[model samples]
Target: MNDEARGAFATRGVGLAGFDAPEARGLPPAATGVRVSSASDTVSRRALAHGQEQLRDGPVADACSALLRAAAGLRETDPAAARRALLAAASAAWSAGDHDSYRRVFAVGPCHLCGAGCASTPCARGCPEAAWRDHRIGMSAMAQGDFRRAIAVLEPRLHQVTPRAETDELCDAGSVALLLGRLPLARRLLSLALASARAAGAETAVPGIIAYLACAELREGRHAQARAHAEEGLVLARRLGQRNVAADLSAVRALVVSIAGDLPTVRAQVAEVLAVAQPHGLAQAAFLAEWAQARAELGAGKVERAAARLAPLVQPGARQGHFGLWFLAVPCFVEACVLSDRALDAPEMVDLFAVWADLGADPQAPAQLARCRALLAPADRSEELYRAALAHHERASGPYEHARTHLAFGMWLRRRRRPTEARDQLRAALVGFEHCGAVLWAERAGAELRAAGEVAGTGEAGPLSSLTPQQVRIARGVARGATNKEIAAELSISIRTVEYHLRNVFAQMGVRSRTGLAHLLANVDEDHGRGWELPDRG
Candidate 1:
C-alpha cells in the first residue's frame, strides 16, 4: 500500500495480517461440476486441427480478423450491426479453434491482458499448444462464477514458472485464492501484482487489484478499512473511466454500508449505482447492488419492503449460487425471528434457525459447526452436536468466521438451560458482530439479556402459560392457512378434536384469525426457560 492508503488503514486500527506461505494446492476442477472421465476421440482432435487452421497466425489477431470480416458484410448504419459482428466473430473463432478469440468475442470483455504470453516466449518455437491451452480455459473459468474450477486450473500454472514466462503466475494464482476464501494470500499476491502494474502504468487494471485488497478487509471484518480502499478504488476507476470496475466498486461500497447498518446512505448510494451500472449492462454489479440495497432495508427492520426487494434476487428458479443471497437470509430470518418474538406468531421462526443450520452443516467445518450447534435447544442432548459442528467450522475456515455462529451457539446453550454458558457465548457474539458492522445480527444478542431476566419480566396469563403441545401444534396449523379439517386430518385426529384444540390455542395464544394466532405467538421466545417443554412427538 502507498503511504496514504496505509495511513488510512492505520487510522481505522487495521493492519495487514502479514503473509504466510501459500497453502497446499488442490487438484484443478472442471468448467462445470459435471466431470467426464472418458478420453476424447480422434474426431475431437481433427476438429481442433480444423479450428486452429482457421487462425494459423496470431490467435487473438485472427479472431479479430474474423469479426472484422463478419461486420463488413453488414450495413454500416444497421442498428444490429455491432451484435451481429460479435456473434459472427465468436462463431469464426470457434471454428478456428481460437479459444482466446472465442472468449473475447463471446464473453463479457474484461481482463484485457490475458493472452500476452500464453506460450514459451524465448523458445525457438513456442511450447506445445496443449501446454498453453489450459491457461486460456482457466481465464474463462475465472470470469464465470465457478471459483472451484478456476482454483483447479490456476494451481499447476502457478507453480510452473519457467525462464521463458512472459508474465508472473502468482498474479493469476492470487486472484483465484481471493475467490476461494484465502484472503491473505490473495492480498499479498495482488499487492505485488499491483506494484508491477503501477510501475508499467497499466492503469487500466489497478482498480481491480485495489478492489481485491478491499475485499480482504471486508472478509476480515475491517469495515472502515474496506470502505476506504473501496472508495479509493472507486475514484481510480472513475478517473480512468473504467465503468465496469467503477460499477463493481460501487456495489462493494453499497454492501459495506448495508453491513454497517447505514441503511439511509446505502439506499441512496445503491440507487446511484443501479442507475449508472444498468445503462452499461453491467449485470453482476446491477444485480448485486439491488440485492445489497434490499439487505440494508432488511437490516433496518423494514420487513415487508425488504422481502419485496429481495423477491427478484431470491425468486425460485433464479440462477442459483449467489453467496450474497444466502448470507442475506441471515438478517431476513433473524428479523422474522424478532417479529415472531414481538407478536408471538411463528413457532416456525425458531425452527427455521434449525433448518438453516442443518442446510449449512454438512459442508461446514468444526468451528462453523459451533454456529450450527447454536441452533439446537440448549441441553445435554445437543452439546455434542454443537461441539462437533464447531470443530468442523473452525477446521474449515478458522474460528472467527462470523458473529452469528457465536451468538446462535449461545442461544442454543440458553435453550438447553445452560444460562451462564449461553451468556458468555452471546456476549462474545454480540461484540464480534457489532465490531463487524453486522448490526441486525449484533442486536439479537440483547435477546440473551432479556432472556436472563425473562421470568421476572413476564406475567403468567394462567391458561396461556400452561399450553399443551397438541394445542400449540393445532394453533400453528391454523396459523399456516390450514383449515380445521386439514389440521385434524394431518394430526390424525377428529375435526371436533381439532376444533377443541383450536379453541384452547386461540384462548391461550390470545388471537382470532390464523394470522393473529401465528403473529401473536411469536411472543413465545418469551418461553425462554419456563419449563414449557412440548410433549415428545412420535
Candidate 2:
C-alpha cells in the first residue's frame, strides 16, 4: 500500500484526536506501494470525471462512484486492475459526454495532466488540450493495432484543435489519419498545422510538416512531390539538431529510397536509422525504424536476420503504447510472418479487429478487417478478405499504405499459384515500394516477378548475395541437406522445428524436393562456411 493507505490503516488505536496522523513509524513498508499508483496521473482524472456523473443520475453516480473507489484500491497495488478501471471510466465518459461524466470518466482519472480544468490553461503553457493524455490512450490503442479506435480516441481532441498543443501530437494525429485514408480530414488538419508551424518559425515542427506534406502528396498520387517533401523534412530536422525528428525523417527517406529501387541503399540506410534510434529512449522511432530495417534485410536476402530482429517489436505486448501502434505493428508483423516463412495466426488482423470493436474505435474496423482476412485467407476463402483489404486501403487512402495491403494480397495469390493475379499485386506492390522508396521491398517484388516468369531478377534465390557470416553457416547446412532438426542438433534445433525449416528452405529456394535442392546446392563451395552434410532421401 502507499504511504497514505499505510497511514490510513496505521490509525489502529481509534483513540486519536487526529494529530496530522503521526508519521507511520518504521521501514519503507515493502508492499507494492499503491493499491494502484500513478492513480494521480491517468486514472484519477477518470475518477473525477465519474464523480461528475454521480452528481447527475444518482444511480450511475453510485455505480461509477463505487467503481472509482474500487479502482483506487487497485491503483496502488495493481496497475492492471487500475487500467481496467480507467478504461471503464473512459467508456462511461463516452457514454455520457457531459461535463460531469467527461470529468469523472477522463479528466479526473489517473494520467491527467495539468488539472481537471486542463482546457482552462491553453494560453499559458505546455501542450494544448493536454495532448499527453489523448496521445497516450490513442497510442496504446494503436499499439494494439487498433487504428480505428485510436482515431476515435484522438479525433475528438484533434478536431478544432487549438495551436496551443505540442506540435508532435498534432502531427501524430495527421499521420494516423493519412494512414487511414481520411484524406479530406488529413489535408485540412495537416495543412493548417503546417501553415501554423511554418508561420511560428517552429523549426522542430518542420519535420512533422514535411511528413504531413509528403504523406498528403503521396495520397494524392503526387509521388515525386512526396519524395521531395520528405527530403526537405530531413534537411530541416538536421538544421534543428533534433535527432528524434531527424530519425523519423530518415524513416521517410528510407521509404522514398525503397521506392527508387536502390535496394542496397535502402537496406543500409534503414539499418543506420535503426542503429541511431535504438539507444535514444525514442521507443516509437526505434520500433518503426527497426521494422523497416528488418524488412530491408528480407529484401537483401537475409531472411533469418530479419526474423530475429522483427518478431519482438511486432508482438502486442512489446508495443503497448507509443503511436500508430497497430497500423504500424500489424502490417509489419504480418509481413514478417509471411516472409519469415511462418504461419499467420496469433494476432492476425482478424483477431485484432475483434479487439478493436470491443474497444469502440471506428465501428468499421471489423468490416475492413474482414478484407485483410480475405486477402490472407486460403485461395477458396478469400474473395471476401480481398475486397475488404481493398476497401480498407482505399478508405485508408494513402498510396503507400494501399500498396502494402496490395503487396500482401499478391503474396497470397502467389502462394495460391494464381500467377496472373499475383503478378498484378506484386507489380502494384513494387510500384508502391518504388513510389515510396521501399527499395528492399521492390527488390523482393522483383524477385517474385522473376520467379513467376514475368521478369528475370534474383529475389531471394539464385545466390546468397547478402548473407553475413552467421547466415552463411546456416545456409550451408541447408544446402548440404541438413534438416533443421539435424541442423538444430548440429546447430541445435528440436526435431519438429527442423522439419519446419526444411519446408521453408524448399520454398525459398524454389525447389520441390531434396534432389532438386541438392542440384542447386552443388554450385556453392565451402569457402563461405559450409553446413553439415545431409542424409540423402534417395
Question: Global CA lDDT of candidate 2, please?
Answer: 0.49
Q: What TM-score would each prediction reach against the true structure?
A: 0.52, 0.51
Name the lDDT value of residue 16 in candidate 1: 11
lDDT of 1 by residue, 1-538 (tens): 1444333222221001111111111111112324322232233333333333332222323544644443433222231443334433443433232334344532322121242232212112443333334544443443333334545765565544432332234454555455455666666676676677777787765776676667666554567777888899899888876555666677778877886567778878888776765454333456557767766665444444555555444332344213122332333433333322322322233333333233221133234434333433345555676556555645453223445566556765664567788777777777776777676556546545345333333233444446554565566455556666555433334689888778777776567767787566545534543322211111
Can you give the lDDT of residue 383 in candidate 1? 68
Query: What's model 2's lDDT at 145?
Result: 42
Identify the runs in model 1 with alpha carbons over 4 angstroms from their true place.
1-126, 136-152, 159-171, 220-222, 302-308, 315-386, 396-401, 415-417, 439-443, 453-538
What C-alpha lDDT values do all the predictions have? 0.48, 0.49
lDDT of 2 by residue, 489-538 (tens): 33222457556656666666677877776666665544445433222211
Q: Report the number of clashing residue pairs per model.
A: 35, 65
Task: Give candidate 2's TM-score.
Answer: 0.51
